[model samples]
Target: MEEQQKKEDGLLNKEETDTLHVDQILRALNPRGRYQILHILLVLLGIPSAGFQLLSNVFIAKRVPHRCAGPPDGSGWSDIFGDTGNLTIVQGRCKLLLTDNSSVVDSAPCVYGHQYKMPENASVISQFDLVCDMDWLARLSQSMVIAGQGVGVVINTFLSDRFGRKTVLVSTSFCLLGCGLAVAYAPNAIVFVVLKFLIGGFQQGILVSKATLFVELLPVEYRSVQSWLSGCTWGFSMMLFAFIAFCFRLRSLFFQTYENDSFMDESLRWLIANGKMKQAQKVIRRIARMNKRSETTILQQIQEKLVLRKENGAEDSERPHKLVGQESCQRLSLLDVLKVKRLLFNSVCLWFCW
Candidate 1:
């Protein structure tokens, strides 16, 4: 009779347990609340910030028009600068005459510094002369940032899972801020490249961790809406970034604060997945109290859900059933990902797309 009463009160049967308890927590918390609205906004900032940081190079590296080397001022060819006013690559471009006017000298590629047409607000490309034969160096510089982001995704995934989402998010945000400031004052291309790589790594770390927190915190039904919300934020920020690119200098602008706030929660799903059931229940109870659900009933539902998950062998198959401790919660490795067939397949596809 008591078991029948438990079933009547929305507890899952032993045969129907699943590992994901987020849906239950969301049900108790109410998907559309002040907490959720703020939480979503908090986590969704990653999309826009990532867009701005990645695309800033376009403006920072904008090409500036230039002209090749010219003869010394004492040479009779001083009239050359006056003759071709603001016109690059004239008929006698890079041509130098000997003091006796007996022989013509051809200027080598950028032997003397090229004269930039625009004196004010010159891009890094113009300042560093990253054009002509050295154009490949510019491409390499931009690509290094993206390569760093790829490495960061793998690293942050393990870090966030092992140390908790909040730790990774906060640390990476500070990293982004520090590296961004450093990039603005980078003395040379080498410094800029190194800083840009760190920017990509930190930017992606915050992005991945925050997005994971956002999705995991919301109910399954609301995740679709949340996806659209995040996409819209990205689109709006991209347009805003375009405007800022024209109106303001990329280095002078600071957009790193979006990743540094404290409006998110430690992921309950992560806690449960790592066998920290007590912590997961505590978080759920707090959420239940805030959302005005019956804390006892919700806790019962969570237990029933876990019991059902055990019956179907879902949780055990996902992770080995071992005593909860440092060993059980050891950091997930790349090999662990490869060992799983579905994960390996998904990873391969993601790599191709990335």
Candidate 2:
């Protein structure tokens, strides 16, 4: 037990160039190291990505649902929401037949909160009134999630090349945390729409940085395992959604919409990973209580990590610089893509007749 504790705390006092085992990776990724912060940033960046992939499935599975789908006079999916709750495959709606008393309802404020409805409502299961219903907002959120991830990929690439993986990671993490909450606090529809795009763009940057770190940290032999781990985590996340849907029913399982209105809901895990250690520790303890696990060891592990990190600061300064100058590094830019595009178009025009 003493040896294991010493092993976990030894990274700072010494630098070993040996191959890393799964235990090493877990220590780097999970317990209380900056690596934990790195991994959390990487995974949370994936939230929007996973959110994007999951959104289409969400839309298809449940069409524009409403609180009372049919009419206030009726109850359940049909009675409460209306015929619009009915799934139509023609429009890519899920072939779901809500056998349960409840059909998925459009919980968007504009639709669900509307005091007055046109006597002849034209929206089908696929169509939610974009003008009134906040469904557009939700859609926008999903788009931003994707867009942010895409942008994060590019920006993080530049960051990786210019800065060390750790620096870029720190930048991306703050961006993600800030942008995520900004989205939650968007004042009106327009703010929500525009910032959502920005958030998606930035989220992509974070992922690129994450991949660089993960790949570099792995021994070449087990790099494939890193890939597998990513795939497995995503698959696991899908199952998480399934569990949420099953446990709470679909209403409580939206990617963006949750009863909790604050930014804390945006990322409880993130709060802990990024220097909010005490807060994160508190959250984890609560989780431990819920799982009926003994957290005494976990708390001790965290303490050891904090101590190692302090020692690590001195260690980093003692090492000679092993990296290159940014000036010589090729920083790919959007302009480069445009130049390639123009060259391709000119070549095609010259060689082939329209």
Q: Estimate candidate 1's alpha-carbon lDDT, on a 0 to 1 scale.
A: 0.67
Q: TM-scores of the models, in the given order?
A: 0.72, 0.41
lDDT of 2 by residue, 54-147 (tens): 3333532244433333334434344433565445211112122333345442432222233223221222122333333345555665576566
By summed lDDT, the worst window of 10 consecutive residues in model 1 runs over 91-100
Instruction: Report how far residue 86 has shifted in candidate 2, in Å.
Output: 31
The candidate that achieves the highest TM-score relative to the unseen native structure: 1
State candidate 2's TM-score: 0.41
Model 2 stretches astray by more than 4 angstroms:
1-141, 245-354
* Residue lDDT tens for model 1, 1-354: 865565345443322323444466577667676666666767766677777888778877777777665545634333443343333333232332222234433333444556666642357676567667666666776798898888898899889878888778888887888887777666877787888888888878888888888777876787788788887998899988877776665444444334555545678767755556556656766676667677667656666766676687766447443332334346556897789899899989978975
TM-score quality measure for candidate 1: 0.72
Model 2 residue 207 CA deviation (Å) reads 1.5
Query: RMSD of each candidate?
Result: 6.9, 15.5
Candidate 1 residue pairs that clash: 17-308, 17-309
- lDDT per prediction? 0.67, 0.44
